[model samples]
Target: MSITRRGFLGASLAAAMDGWQPAAAAGARVTLDQLQPGVYVARAHNAEVARANAGEVVPTLVHVTGAGVLVVDPGPQAAWGGALLGAIRALTPQPVRWVVNTHAHPENVLANAALARLRPRPVFLASAATAALMRQRCADCLARLQAQLGRAAMRGTTIVLPEPALQAGGWLHTGATAWQVQVHDNAHSASDTVLYAPQLRLLCAGGLAYQERVPEMQEASLQGWRQALRQLAALPADTVVATAPGTPAQTLVPTLAYLDALASGIGAALAAGCDASHAIDAVAAAPFRRWRHFHARHPLNVQRAWRQLEDLWMQGEPLA
Candidate 1:
């Protein structure tokens, strides 16, 4: 039986509400930096997720509009979300009218439960695929995070799936401010959502772009991600909100360079008949070792790229 969006969200919410408890007070602090008149970004650490960071290693974006507020990627857990809400309140008294989850990753969406506490709860949205993935995986993702960060750190964190899936080419408007939603599938994740505000010349490329940090490849498509980066580069955006610290113009550069080197190295290894076991070591990691979490994430990226390339080769697709 096919499940409709409303039915799916209703069922998910019903289940989530059964054991729902008020989230513990926010322990992590979120500070917003104005990117544009109505746009702001709270940058996260470029290191790996752990108990110290409280899994708060993803940026949170806030856009204040004449009608209300719109938040993107609330945060890692309920406390982080609560901290984010407090940060937003410091800027404006406007109610948060919309909450957009750019993807299904727990670091980005689990905070939805905390944000739901807002008066006249904000409408939560994500791409259809993202919502589906959240339903399928967020419970495990939440549990895993709790284990990694400890129960006290992840207190009150729960899976909160977005509803009324957003679509590409759709425009989200709040009075004078507007955002053009663009969805790229099989790139950074199963589905990635990017927001472009023409008036502000800003692009919020969620998980598609990272800066000063090795890109995570657990659920990424190297080829597809490269294509998405190309598309983003061609945009007229003056600022790109990425995972690490860097100028907006240079936001996609580091990630693009890393991806290119990874793909080329893997392709060369395949051409040399190197097995997957040796392929990880064969990739040139010297250049990226200086990047944050390089030791932890680069080898995994190489393995993932090698597997993907092997599958493509089996289908007779030429490596680019």
Candidate 2:
């Protein structure tokens, strides 16, 4: 099925409204200098990239509270995490009292050691599944990355699991606010959480939500992801933040559409073929062709979605 010109324009418009500003066209590069007084934004770009790789620039933010400071998602390694910690210090002297991991991603959880060095160690928080994934898989995750990226580059970075895991079905309190954090399992990752700050009206979602690009997934549950967004829409948050090209203030639209499009494409493929590879290739080649660069990654998002859909179909589960 061909995407009509009108459909393409609609997708393009949605992408624009939701933070898919073209890097070349917008000529907008979010830097630390442009941050506001109460906000601190840090992007960790990979040290290896010659032209500055986007992987290294995972922007983490710190919001200053009257009582103390609240941090959202620490970077994957010490270099990025340490840089983020330093940026927060420059913004304020107040000890960070609360640390929230938007989801269980290595890039977001590898900097707890440096953050703990503060006078008062901040309490770490994540969704129940995220906490389990962190505790069970964090160290091995870092080790694997070190093996792949080389230990020298991954120096001073260890996976430190957060205490007090967020349980399913409700909000969790951190600092002065009862943050409406939801536990969304098997969506973007094994377990992803979306944080909704009523006071700030900000939604800090990890990989479950991304900005200006396709949603990267290792293990994705399409139905769960769609439902999670529906749940998030009911929250009081007006602004959505994620690990992306810019700060949390700018909403992420591409990630949402990426998931929706993947689900749609996969459903069509399953009806046409019995093999998962065929489904994956067809989906990746069709509606997702424009996102070819993203397809280079191993076990690409479509493949992951295909696997998840296979499990669901095998169990006779209903599709979204």
Candidate 3:
């Protein structure tokens, strides 16, 4: 069955009723007192860059283990990472045993160095493919950021590369809890990984799923992204925390709708002989605009969709 926007919203509402609030809402002002025992999200509150933006809010997670605490995707910048660690310390004195990077986005994985300052030197984990993608693509991404945001806004920007990369079916064990980290390469970005705790049926989906906004689809693999979400839907992840904070912890449908809309909208535009810019405008003016994050991400999503459609059509394949 096709997942629609309404269906996605309904899923989000259901998750809310199950005790998923904006974990990052508290991170807006100060480091939290303690991340509760259960799954809790950390939201980056950037007054200048992300205040007006609802989705740019980065998602980090804290999980308690009998051995020590595990931290996931420490915000983007050093300061944000420090604040996250501060928040974690407020929760437990147990050293951080692991620092997991969901992907290579500066706003997502650049805090490994700071996190390594811990007593145990947390093992920074990422997919081998993602680690390579960072080395090859990060310089270009940073250059683009410099061009777009200019030098002033690009201060303190560092590209982090992950070590001890995971292969397929990679597993990490901490205390009584175990995490299964898998690489769903060539999806949202060049490479992506999501953390799942099967025992709890909880998912830490980095960029694979976003909420409360449209996706920033630059460098996105539209078809691959769709396939990945399909695989995710097959999981029993009852609680989902996305890369964007305040996103309901278990809504799989919204991300599905956004991906499906982009694919279908691209197909419709192409069949109508619309140009890339025209397709972007048309999609944004119609179906895409209904999304809360549409204003910020529709243009990029359209660009990616058009490219993907163009490639597929040229190869004599129908858009899926």
Q: Where is model 3 more than 4 Å wrong at Cα?
A: 1-36, 45-56, 137-160, 245-250, 269-278, 281-290
Ranking by lDDT: 1, 3, 2
Q: Report the lDDT of model 2 for residue 306.
A: 81
Report lDDT per candidate. 0.78, 0.59, 0.64
Compared with the true structure, what per-residue lDDT tens digits does model 2 show for residues 4-91? 1111112322232242212132111223432444655554442322223422545666677667878777665554444454455455
lDDT of 1 by residue, 211-239 (tens): 77789899899999998998888888888
Q: All candidates' TM-scores? A: 0.88, 0.75, 0.77
Q: Give the true-structure RMSD of model 2.
A: 12.0
| Regions of model 2 farther than 4 Å from truth | 1-37, 44-55, 169-176, 234-236, 245-252, 272-292, 297-299, 314-316
Local error of candidate 1 at residue 251 (angstroms): 2.4
Q: Candidate 2, clashing residue pairs?
A: 44-56, 44-57, 44-58, 45-56, 45-57, 46-56, 76-107
Candidate 3, run of 10 with poorest lDDT: 1-10
| Alpha carbon lDDT at 206, candidate 2 | 67
Models sorted by TM-score, best on top: 1, 3, 2
| lDDT at position 86, candidate 3 | 55
lDDT, model 3? 0.64
Q: What is the lDDT of residue 43 in candidate 3?
A: 50
